[model samples]
Target: MNDCVAWSGGRPVEWLLTNAPVDKHWCTIHATHMTAEEATALAASGAVVGLCPTTEANLGDGLFPFEDYAGAEGNWGVGTDSHVSVSPIAELRLLEYGQRIARQERNIAAGTQDRSTGRALLEHAWAGGSQASGRSTGGLEVGQRADILSLNENHPVLVGRTGDEILDSWIFSGENTPVQNVMVGGKWVIRDGHHEREEEILDNYATVLRRLST
Candidate 1:
Protein backbone atom coordinates (compact mmCIF):
# COMPACT_ATOMS: atom_id res chain seq x y z
CA MET A 1 0.00 0.00 0.00
CA ASN A 2 2.85 2.42 0.93
CA ASP A 3 0.55 5.28 1.85
CA CYS A 4 -1.61 5.12 -1.23
CA VAL A 5 -3.75 8.12 -2.14
CA ALA A 6 -5.86 8.50 -5.27
CA TRP A 7 -3.05 8.05 -7.74
CA SER A 8 -4.22 7.33 -11.30
CA GLY A 9 -7.80 8.02 -10.27
CA GLY A 10 -7.78 4.97 -7.91
CA ARG A 11 -6.94 2.53 -10.67
CA PRO A 12 -4.02 1.41 -8.51
CA VAL A 13 -6.44 0.10 -5.90
CA GLU A 14 -8.39 -1.89 -8.48
CA TRP A 15 -5.21 -3.22 -10.01
CA LEU A 16 -3.70 -4.23 -6.67
CA LEU A 17 -6.89 -5.88 -5.46
CA THR A 18 -7.21 -7.81 -8.66
CA ASN A 19 -3.60 -8.97 -8.72
CA ALA A 20 -2.88 -9.54 -5.02
CA PRO A 21 -3.77 -12.75 -3.26
CA VAL A 22 -6.72 -12.61 -0.87
CA ASP A 23 -5.98 -12.10 2.84
CA LYS A 24 -2.28 -12.35 2.05
CA HIS A 25 -1.55 -9.00 0.45
CA TRP A 26 -3.47 -6.40 2.41
CA CYS A 27 -2.92 -2.70 1.68
CA THR A 28 -2.75 0.53 3.58
CA ILE A 29 -5.02 2.69 1.46
CA HIS A 30 -3.97 6.12 2.69
CA ALA A 31 -7.19 7.48 1.31
CA THR A 32 -7.22 11.29 1.33
CA HIS A 33 -7.75 11.45 -2.42
CA MET A 34 -10.15 8.51 -2.60
CA THR A 35 -13.79 9.16 -3.47
CA ALA A 36 -16.77 7.65 -1.66
CA GLU A 37 -17.19 4.96 -4.27
CA GLU A 38 -13.49 4.18 -4.15
CA ALA A 39 -13.56 3.98 -0.37
CA THR A 40 -16.60 1.70 -0.46
CA ALA A 41 -14.86 -0.61 -2.89
CA LEU A 42 -11.71 -0.62 -0.77
CA ALA A 43 -13.81 -1.44 2.30
CA ALA A 44 -15.61 -4.25 0.52
CA SER A 45 -12.24 -5.64 -0.52
CA GLY A 46 -11.34 -5.93 3.19
CA ALA A 47 -8.20 -3.81 2.93
CA VAL A 48 -6.95 -1.79 5.90
CA VAL A 49 -6.85 1.95 5.34
CA GLY A 50 -3.98 3.63 7.19
CA LEU A 51 -5.14 7.10 8.17
CA CYS A 52 -2.56 9.64 9.32
CA PRO A 53 -4.74 12.66 10.03
CA THR A 54 -2.05 14.95 11.43
CA THR A 55 0.35 14.16 8.62
CA GLU A 56 -2.38 14.63 6.07
CA ALA A 57 -3.19 18.03 7.51
CA ASN A 58 0.51 18.96 7.63
CA LEU A 59 0.90 18.01 3.97
CA GLY A 60 -2.25 19.87 2.95
CA ASP A 61 -3.82 16.62 1.79
CA GLY A 62 -7.57 16.73 1.39
CA LEU A 63 -9.71 15.65 4.30
CA PHE A 64 -10.53 11.96 4.43
CA PRO A 65 -14.20 11.21 3.89
CA PHE A 66 -14.52 9.54 7.29
CA GLU A 67 -18.33 9.64 7.38
CA ASP A 68 -18.60 8.00 4.01
CA TYR A 69 -15.95 5.42 4.88
CA ALA A 70 -17.60 4.55 8.20
CA GLY A 71 -20.98 4.37 6.50
CA ALA A 72 -19.56 1.60 4.33
CA GLU A 73 -18.25 -0.27 7.41
CA GLY A 74 -14.68 0.17 6.23
CA ASN A 75 -11.61 -1.33 7.88
CA TRP A 76 -9.49 1.63 8.88
CA GLY A 77 -6.85 2.50 11.45
CA VAL A 78 -4.85 5.56 12.55
CA GLY A 79 -1.10 5.95 12.27
CA THR A 80 1.57 8.53 13.08
CA ASP A 81 3.08 8.26 9.65
CA SER A 82 5.35 11.28 9.79
CA HIS A 83 5.92 11.00 13.54
CA VAL A 84 4.88 14.65 13.79
CA SER A 85 2.36 13.70 16.47
CA VAL A 86 3.00 10.38 18.18
CA SER A 87 -0.01 10.12 20.46
CA PRO A 88 -3.02 8.00 19.55
CA ILE A 89 -5.27 10.53 21.27
CA ALA A 90 -3.96 13.28 19.00
CA GLU A 91 -4.63 11.15 15.94
CA LEU A 92 -8.19 10.30 17.00
CA ARG A 93 -8.94 13.87 18.08
CA LEU A 94 -7.70 15.38 14.84
CA LEU A 95 -9.49 12.73 12.78
CA GLU A 96 -12.84 13.54 14.36
CA TYR A 97 -12.21 17.27 14.33
CA GLY A 98 -11.44 17.20 10.61
CA GLN A 99 -14.72 15.38 9.95
CA ARG A 100 -16.70 17.78 12.12
CA ILE A 101 -15.25 20.79 10.37
CA ALA A 102 -15.83 19.29 6.93
CA ARG A 103 -19.41 18.21 7.63
CA GLN A 104 -20.21 21.24 9.82
CA GLU A 105 -21.49 18.94 12.56
CA ARG A 106 -20.31 17.79 15.94
CA ASN A 107 -19.69 14.17 16.92
CA ILE A 108 -19.53 13.20 13.29
CA ALA A 109 -17.45 10.11 14.03
CA ALA A 110 -20.05 8.66 16.37
CA GLY A 111 -21.71 5.52 15.10
CA THR A 112 -25.43 5.24 14.43
CA GLN A 113 -25.89 2.93 17.44
CA ASP A 114 -23.23 4.45 19.72
CA ARG A 115 -23.29 8.19 20.18
CA SER A 116 -19.87 8.33 21.87
CA THR A 117 -17.55 9.46 19.14
CA GLY A 118 -14.51 8.65 21.23
CA ARG A 119 -15.62 5.12 21.95
CA ALA A 120 -16.56 4.48 18.33
CA LEU A 121 -13.25 5.83 17.07
CA LEU A 122 -11.31 3.81 19.62
CA GLU A 123 -13.07 0.56 18.77
CA HIS A 124 -12.75 1.07 15.05
CA ALA A 125 -9.04 1.83 15.34
CA TRP A 126 -8.46 -1.10 17.67
CA ALA A 127 -10.19 -3.56 15.36
CA GLY A 128 -8.52 -2.20 12.27
CA GLY A 129 -5.11 -2.12 13.97
CA SER A 130 -5.44 -5.72 15.05
CA GLN A 131 -5.98 -6.69 11.44
CA ALA A 132 -3.27 -4.36 10.17
CA SER A 133 -0.60 -5.57 12.57
CA GLY A 134 -1.69 -9.21 12.59
CA ARG A 135 -1.64 -9.01 16.36
CA SER A 136 -4.04 -10.98 18.55
CA THR A 137 -4.48 -8.03 20.89
CA GLY A 138 -6.16 -4.64 20.63
CA GLY A 139 -8.78 -5.02 23.32
CA LEU A 140 -8.97 -7.16 26.42
CA GLU A 141 -9.87 -10.74 25.63
CA VAL A 142 -8.85 -14.30 26.34
CA GLY A 143 -5.88 -15.60 24.30
CA GLN A 144 -4.88 -12.00 23.51
CA ARG A 145 -1.92 -10.11 24.88
CA ALA A 146 -2.70 -8.07 27.99
CA ASP A 147 -1.86 -4.60 26.77
CA ILE A 148 -3.50 -1.92 28.85
CA LEU A 149 -3.25 1.79 29.65
CA SER A 150 -4.44 3.24 32.95
CA LEU A 151 -5.54 6.85 32.71
CA ASN A 152 -5.01 9.38 35.46
CA GLU A 153 -8.48 9.87 36.85
CA ASN A 154 -7.15 12.62 39.08
CA HIS A 155 -5.95 14.63 36.09
CA PRO A 156 -7.75 17.92 35.57
CA VAL A 157 -9.11 16.86 32.20
CA LEU A 158 -10.60 13.70 33.65
CA VAL A 159 -11.97 15.12 36.90
CA GLY A 160 -15.50 13.78 37.48
CA ARG A 161 -15.50 12.13 34.07
CA THR A 162 -17.04 8.65 33.94
CA GLY A 163 -17.56 5.80 31.49
CA ASP A 164 -17.30 6.95 27.89
CA GLU A 165 -16.86 10.50 29.09
CA ILE A 166 -13.44 9.47 30.36
CA LEU A 167 -12.42 8.46 26.85
CA ASP A 168 -13.95 11.59 25.38
CA SER A 169 -12.13 13.88 27.78
CA TRP A 170 -8.86 12.05 27.38
CA ILE A 171 -8.96 12.41 23.63
CA PHE A 172 -10.43 15.87 23.33
CA SER A 173 -9.39 17.78 26.43
CA GLY A 174 -6.38 16.16 28.04
CA GLU A 175 -3.00 17.89 27.92
CA ASN A 176 0.28 15.94 27.56
CA THR A 177 0.15 12.22 28.31
CA PRO A 178 -2.64 11.45 30.73
CA VAL A 179 -1.64 7.80 30.94
CA GLN A 180 -0.56 6.95 34.49
CA ASN A 181 0.53 3.41 33.82
CA VAL A 182 1.09 1.28 30.76
CA MET A 183 1.21 -2.51 30.85
CA VAL A 184 2.29 -4.43 27.82
CA GLY A 185 1.86 -8.23 27.90
CA GLY A 186 1.10 -7.99 31.59
CA LYS A 187 4.41 -6.21 32.28
CA TRP A 188 4.56 -2.72 33.72
CA VAL A 189 6.61 -0.52 31.38
CA ILE A 190 5.39 2.89 32.40
CA ARG A 191 4.40 3.97 35.89
CA ASP A 192 3.20 7.35 37.09
CA GLY A 193 3.46 8.82 33.59
CA HIS A 194 7.16 7.99 33.26
CA HIS A 195 8.75 5.12 31.39
CA GLU A 196 10.94 2.93 33.57
CA ARG A 197 14.04 3.72 31.51
CA GLU A 198 13.26 7.36 30.88
CA GLU A 199 16.60 8.84 31.89
CA GLU A 200 18.72 6.28 30.08
CA ILE A 201 16.52 6.45 27.00
CA LEU A 202 16.68 10.23 26.90
CA ASP A 203 20.44 10.22 27.36
CA ASN A 204 20.93 7.81 24.47
CA TYR A 205 18.42 9.69 22.29
CA ALA A 206 20.24 12.97 22.90
CA THR A 207 23.53 11.36 22.05
CA VAL A 208 22.12 10.07 18.76
CA LEU A 209 20.68 13.47 17.88
CA ARG A 210 24.02 15.16 18.63
CA ARG A 211 25.90 12.67 16.47
CA LEU A 212 23.40 13.17 13.63
CA SER A 213 23.70 16.95 13.87
CA THR A 214 27.44 16.73 13.22
Candidate 2:
Protein backbone atom coordinates (compact mmCIF):
# COMPACT_ATOMS: atom_id res chain seq x y z
CA MET A 1 0.00 0.00 0.00
CA ASN A 2 2.74 2.42 0.95
CA ASP A 3 4.69 1.68 -2.19
CA CYS A 4 1.61 1.88 -4.40
CA VAL A 5 0.55 5.19 -2.89
CA ALA A 6 4.04 6.66 -3.18
CA TRP A 7 4.83 5.35 -6.64
CA SER A 8 1.47 5.43 -8.44
CA GLY A 9 0.59 9.09 -7.70
CA GLY A 10 -2.84 8.05 -6.31
CA ARG A 11 -3.80 6.00 -9.40
CA PRO A 12 -2.21 2.73 -8.38
CA VAL A 13 -4.66 0.30 -9.97
CA GLU A 14 -4.72 2.14 -13.30
CA TRP A 15 -0.96 2.60 -13.36
CA LEU A 16 -0.27 -1.02 -12.57
CA LEU A 17 -2.83 -2.29 -15.06
CA THR A 18 -1.53 0.01 -17.78
CA ASN A 19 2.06 -1.07 -17.19
CA ALA A 20 1.40 -4.82 -16.95
CA PRO A 21 1.62 -7.10 -19.96
CA VAL A 22 -1.57 -8.39 -21.56
CA ASP A 23 -0.32 -11.92 -22.16
CA LYS A 24 0.68 -12.41 -18.54
CA HIS A 25 -0.66 -11.77 -15.03
CA TRP A 26 -1.20 -8.64 -12.95
CA CYS A 27 -0.39 -10.06 -9.54
CA THR A 28 -0.49 -9.16 -5.84
CA ILE A 29 -4.33 -9.10 -5.62
CA HIS A 30 -4.63 -5.37 -6.31
CA ALA A 31 -8.38 -5.23 -5.61
CA THR A 32 -8.06 -3.78 -2.13
CA HIS A 33 -7.70 -0.31 -3.55
CA MET A 34 -9.50 -0.83 -6.85
CA THR A 35 -12.58 1.17 -7.67
CA ALA A 36 -15.65 -0.53 -9.18
CA GLU A 37 -14.63 0.67 -12.63
CA GLU A 38 -11.08 -0.53 -12.22
CA ALA A 39 -12.32 -3.84 -10.88
CA THR A 40 -14.65 -4.31 -13.85
CA ALA A 41 -11.94 -3.33 -16.33
CA LEU A 42 -9.42 -5.65 -14.69
CA ALA A 43 -11.91 -8.50 -14.88
CA ALA A 44 -12.59 -7.78 -18.52
CA SER A 45 -8.87 -7.40 -19.29
CA GLY A 46 -8.45 -11.13 -18.49
CA ALA A 47 -5.32 -10.82 -16.36
CA VAL A 48 -5.31 -13.34 -13.54
CA VAL A 49 -4.91 -11.72 -10.14
CA GLY A 50 -2.56 -13.87 -8.08
CA LEU A 51 -4.10 -13.90 -4.61
CA CYS A 52 -1.65 -15.31 -2.07
CA PRO A 53 -3.89 -15.51 0.96
CA THR A 54 -1.42 -17.24 3.26
CA THR A 55 1.34 -14.79 2.44
CA GLU A 56 -1.02 -11.84 2.77
CA ALA A 57 -2.09 -13.02 6.21
CA ASN A 58 1.48 -13.79 7.25
CA LEU A 59 2.57 -10.27 6.33
CA GLY A 60 -0.67 -8.60 7.50
CA ASP A 61 -0.96 -7.08 4.04
CA GLY A 62 -4.75 -6.56 4.38
CA LEU A 63 -7.87 -8.30 3.16
CA PHE A 64 -8.43 -8.73 -0.56
CA PRO A 65 -11.70 -7.41 -1.92
CA PHE A 66 -13.20 -10.80 -2.68
CA GLU A 67 -16.70 -9.44 -3.23
CA ASP A 68 -15.48 -6.74 -5.56
CA TYR A 69 -13.09 -8.91 -7.54
CA ALA A 70 -15.38 -11.92 -7.92
CA GLY A 71 -18.35 -9.67 -8.32
CA ALA A 72 -16.66 -8.29 -11.41
CA GLU A 73 -16.17 -11.85 -12.72
CA GLY A 74 -12.43 -11.53 -12.26
CA ASN A 75 -9.90 -14.15 -13.14
CA TRP A 76 -8.02 -15.08 -9.99
CA GLY A 77 -5.59 -17.67 -8.64
CA VAL A 78 -3.65 -18.60 -5.50
CA GLY A 79 0.12 -18.33 -4.99
CA THR A 80 2.73 -19.07 -2.30
CA ASP A 81 4.33 -15.67 -2.34
CA SER A 82 7.31 -15.39 0.09
CA HIS A 83 6.92 -19.16 0.65
CA VAL A 84 4.80 -18.65 3.74
CA SER A 85 2.75 -21.71 2.82
CA VAL A 86 3.33 -23.96 -0.18
CA SER A 87 0.26 -26.10 0.24
CA PRO A 88 -2.42 -25.31 -2.33
CA ILE A 89 -4.98 -26.45 0.24
CA ALA A 90 -3.70 -23.84 2.69
CA GLU A 91 -3.96 -21.12 0.10
CA LEU A 92 -7.48 -22.01 -1.00
CA ARG A 93 -8.70 -22.69 2.50
CA LEU A 94 -7.43 -19.37 3.76
CA LEU A 95 -8.77 -17.51 0.76
CA GLU A 96 -12.30 -18.66 1.51
CA TYR A 97 -11.87 -18.46 5.27
CA GLY A 98 -10.58 -14.92 5.05
CA GLN A 99 -13.51 -13.85 2.97
CA ARG A 100 -15.93 -15.60 5.30
CA ILE A 101 -14.44 -13.76 8.26
CA ALA A 102 -14.39 -10.39 6.56
CA ARG A 103 -17.89 -10.60 5.14
CA GLN A 104 -19.45 -12.40 8.13
CA GLU A 105 -20.80 -14.99 5.75
CA ARG A 106 -20.22 -18.63 4.82
CA ASN A 107 -19.35 -20.41 1.58
CA ILE A 108 -18.31 -17.16 -0.04
CA ALA A 109 -16.08 -18.88 -2.56
CA ALA A 110 -18.84 -20.99 -4.07
CA GLY A 111 -20.96 -17.87 -4.74
CA THR A 112 -24.06 -20.06 -4.97
CA GLN A 113 -26.03 -22.62 -3.00
CA ASP A 114 -25.78 -25.56 -5.38
CA ARG A 115 -22.00 -25.29 -5.86
CA SER A 116 -19.60 -27.07 -3.55
CA THR A 117 -17.26 -24.58 -1.90
CA GLY A 118 -14.09 -26.63 -2.29
CA ARG A 119 -14.93 -27.59 -5.84
CA ALA A 120 -15.53 -24.01 -6.87
CA LEU A 121 -12.30 -22.82 -5.26
CA LEU A 122 -10.29 -25.62 -6.84
CA GLU A 123 -11.63 -25.00 -10.34
CA HIS A 124 -11.05 -21.27 -10.10
CA ALA A 125 -7.48 -21.74 -8.90
CA TRP A 126 -6.68 -24.46 -11.40
CA ALA A 127 -7.85 -22.57 -14.47
CA GLY A 128 -6.48 -19.22 -13.34
CA GLY A 129 -3.12 -20.69 -12.36
CA SER A 130 -2.77 -22.36 -15.71
CA GLN A 131 -3.78 -19.22 -17.59
CA ALA A 132 -1.51 -16.99 -15.50
CA SER A 133 1.40 -19.37 -16.13
CA GLY A 134 0.60 -19.23 -19.84
CA ARG A 135 0.82 -23.00 -19.87
CA SER A 136 -1.33 -25.62 -21.55
CA THR A 137 -2.01 -27.45 -18.29
CA GLY A 138 -5.48 -26.40 -17.27
CA GLY A 139 -7.51 -29.63 -17.34
CA LEU A 140 -7.47 -33.36 -17.96
CA GLU A 141 -8.05 -33.30 -21.68
CA VAL A 142 -6.34 -33.95 -24.98
CA GLY A 143 -3.83 -31.24 -26.08
CA GLN A 144 -3.30 -30.27 -22.42
CA ARG A 145 -0.23 -30.94 -20.35
CA ALA A 146 -0.68 -34.12 -18.30
CA ASP A 147 -0.40 -32.43 -14.94
CA ILE A 148 -2.16 -34.46 -12.27
CA LEU A 149 -2.61 -34.74 -8.52
CA SER A 150 -3.64 -38.14 -7.20
CA LEU A 151 -4.93 -38.24 -3.66
CA ASN A 152 -4.37 -41.14 -1.31
CA GLU A 153 -7.65 -42.94 -1.63
CA ASN A 154 -6.81 -44.97 1.44
CA HIS A 155 -6.17 -41.96 3.65
CA PRO A 156 -8.53 -42.13 6.63
CA VAL A 157 -9.98 -38.69 6.02
CA LEU A 158 -10.42 -39.43 2.35
CA VAL A 159 -11.73 -43.00 2.55
CA GLY A 160 -15.14 -43.29 0.84
CA ARG A 161 -15.14 -39.65 -0.25
CA THR A 162 -15.89 -39.31 -3.96
CA GLY A 163 -15.98 -36.60 -6.59
CA ASP A 164 -16.11 -33.08 -5.14
CA GLU A 165 -16.35 -34.64 -1.69
CA ILE A 166 -12.76 -35.79 -2.09
CA LEU A 167 -11.65 -32.25 -2.75
CA ASP A 168 -13.79 -30.98 0.10
CA SER A 169 -12.31 -33.55 2.45
CA TRP A 170 -8.74 -32.85 1.43
CA ILE A 171 -8.95 -29.08 1.37
CA PHE A 172 -11.17 -28.53 4.39
CA SER A 173 -10.57 -31.59 6.55
CA GLY A 174 -7.06 -31.72 8.02
CA GLU A 175 -3.41 -30.66 7.88
CA ASN A 176 -1.92 -34.02 6.89
CA THR A 177 -1.26 -34.21 3.18
CA PRO A 178 -3.39 -36.78 1.39
CA VAL A 179 -1.70 -36.50 -1.99
CA GLN A 180 -0.12 -39.85 -2.78
CA ASN A 181 1.23 -39.07 -6.21
CA VAL A 182 1.87 -36.23 -8.61
CA MET A 183 2.57 -36.42 -12.30
CA VAL A 184 3.64 -33.72 -14.72
CA GLY A 185 3.78 -34.25 -18.47
CA GLY A 186 3.13 -37.95 -17.98
CA LYS A 187 6.15 -38.34 -15.64
CA TRP A 188 5.95 -39.10 -11.95
CA VAL A 189 7.67 -36.53 -9.74
CA ILE A 190 6.07 -37.57 -6.47
CA ARG A 191 4.95 -41.07 -5.49
CA ASP A 192 3.87 -42.61 -2.20
CA GLY A 193 3.93 -39.17 -0.59
CA HIS A 194 7.60 -38.50 -1.30
CA HIS A 195 9.39 -36.52 -3.95
CA GLU A 196 11.71 -38.68 -6.07
CA ARG A 197 14.74 -36.54 -5.16
CA GLU A 198 13.75 -35.50 -1.65
CA GLU A 199 17.10 -36.10 0.06
CA GLU A 200 19.12 -34.45 -2.69
CA ILE A 201 16.69 -31.54 -2.84
CA LEU A 202 16.95 -31.02 0.93
CA ASP A 203 20.73 -31.17 0.79
CA ASN A 204 20.87 -28.57 -1.97
CA TYR A 205 18.33 -26.42 -0.10
CA ALA A 206 20.50 -26.51 3.04
CA THR A 207 23.57 -25.55 1.02
CA VAL A 208 21.73 -22.60 -0.50
CA LEU A 209 20.38 -21.58 2.90
CA ARG A 210 23.89 -21.53 4.36
CA ARG A 211 25.24 -19.52 1.46
CA LEU A 212 22.40 -17.01 1.66
CA SER A 213 22.70 -16.68 5.44
CA THR A 214 26.39 -15.95 5.15
**Which candidate's TM-score is highest?**
1
Per-residue CA lDDT of candidate 1, range 1-214, in tens? 3334344343555555566653423746466766677667777877788788888888887788777778888888888885667877888999989988887788877855458888988988888877888887787778887888899999888889999998888889845657899998899999999999999999999999999999
Residue 188, model 1, lDDT: 97
Write out the backbone clash pairs for model 2: none
Off by over 4 Å in 1: 1-10, 22-25, 112-114
TM-scores for candidates 1 onward, in order: 0.89, 0.89
Q: Which regions of candidate 2 deviate over 4 angstroms?
A: 18-31, 210-214
User: Highest lDDT among the candidates is held by which one?
Assistant: 2
Local accuracy of candidate 2 as per-residue lDDT tens digits, 1-214: 5687787765666776678765345454535567777777778787788888888788787777778879988888887766647888998998898899988888898998777999999999988888877788868889899999888889998999888888888988868989999998889999999999999999999999999999
lDDT of each: 0.79, 0.82
* Counted clashes in each candidate structure: 0, 0
Give the Cα-based TM-score of candidate 2 against the true structure.
0.89
TM-score between model 1 and native: 0.89
